[model samples]
Target: MREVTLTHRECVKLIGSPERARYGMVSVDGREPRRLTCLIVGDGDLLIDLDRERPIERPIAGRPIAVEFTHHDQRGNGGWTVTGLGLARPIRDGDKPIPMPYTTLTVGAFETGVRVCIARLTGRRTRPTQI
Candidate 1:
């Protein structure tokens, strides 16, 4: 439950990497949370797959949204953080004459996934510590 931001360059690097299973909770315009499975497309755009557990309403493009998730490296070390996502654009898969209601968002902002916690020390010298 932390806030994070990622630049367009960083986002491209992340999504361009090898495929992996990454899951996160996405909130659009402060609406109810929804489960999201993201896949980085060849163009570095995020193909967000929505969970069908609950009904999904399409989000308007250019709306502010936030996503929180944990990222894992090849060594399997990652932490949880919240990211402020840029404008959300709705995208559909395939070239059907009729369009689906799925959505895809671009990585347009940047934020670090680092969480800093402060603790009060009793009977000990106060020092800065990061968790």
Candidate 2:
């Protein structure tokens, strides 16, 4: 486990590759991390979407969070993992309301109301290991 500092361009190149799984695990307040769908990967952060497990639960903006993304694809090769710390910011539409993007999955397309959040990386470390 070594810390590899990646430039913005390098981060995009490695993370944007199709070989990487389109999912990440995110945790807040030192709680157990949960799997989140990777919505969009930016130069310094990622847009993640998740549903509230309970009606009254949701991670608020400005909260600290930990994120992890890994590579896993058709080749079945052992992949690397990128872990980082970030802050969560809920996506807002200028005070109008949150916009739940219409996302389509294996089943079909539907506008499922989900909590969209941004994990703005403050620090990151890379792990290169073989299975």
Clashing pairs in 1: 2-82, 4-82, 5-110, 5-111, 6-109, 6-110, 6-111, 7-110
Give one digit per residue, the lDDT tens place, for model 1 in 40-85.
4433344453333134454435565565544443443433232435
- TM for every model, in the order presented, reads 0.44, 0.55
Worst 10 residues of 1 by lDDT: 113-122
**Model 1: residues with Cα > 4 Å off, grouped in runs:** 1-8, 42-44, 50-54, 72-82, 92-131
lDDT of 1 at 92: 40
Please name the candidate that would achieve the greatest lDDT relative to the true structure: 2
- Candidate 2 per-residue C-alpha lDDT over 1-131 given as tens digits, one digit per residue, 9 for 90 to 100: 44556554555566556432245677776777877655443454555433422321364466776777665444643345566666666644331123433344221111222223433433244444534
The per-model lDDT (C-alpha) reads 0.40, 0.49
- On TM-score, the leading prediction is 2
Instruction: Give the clash count for each candidate.
Output: 8, 0
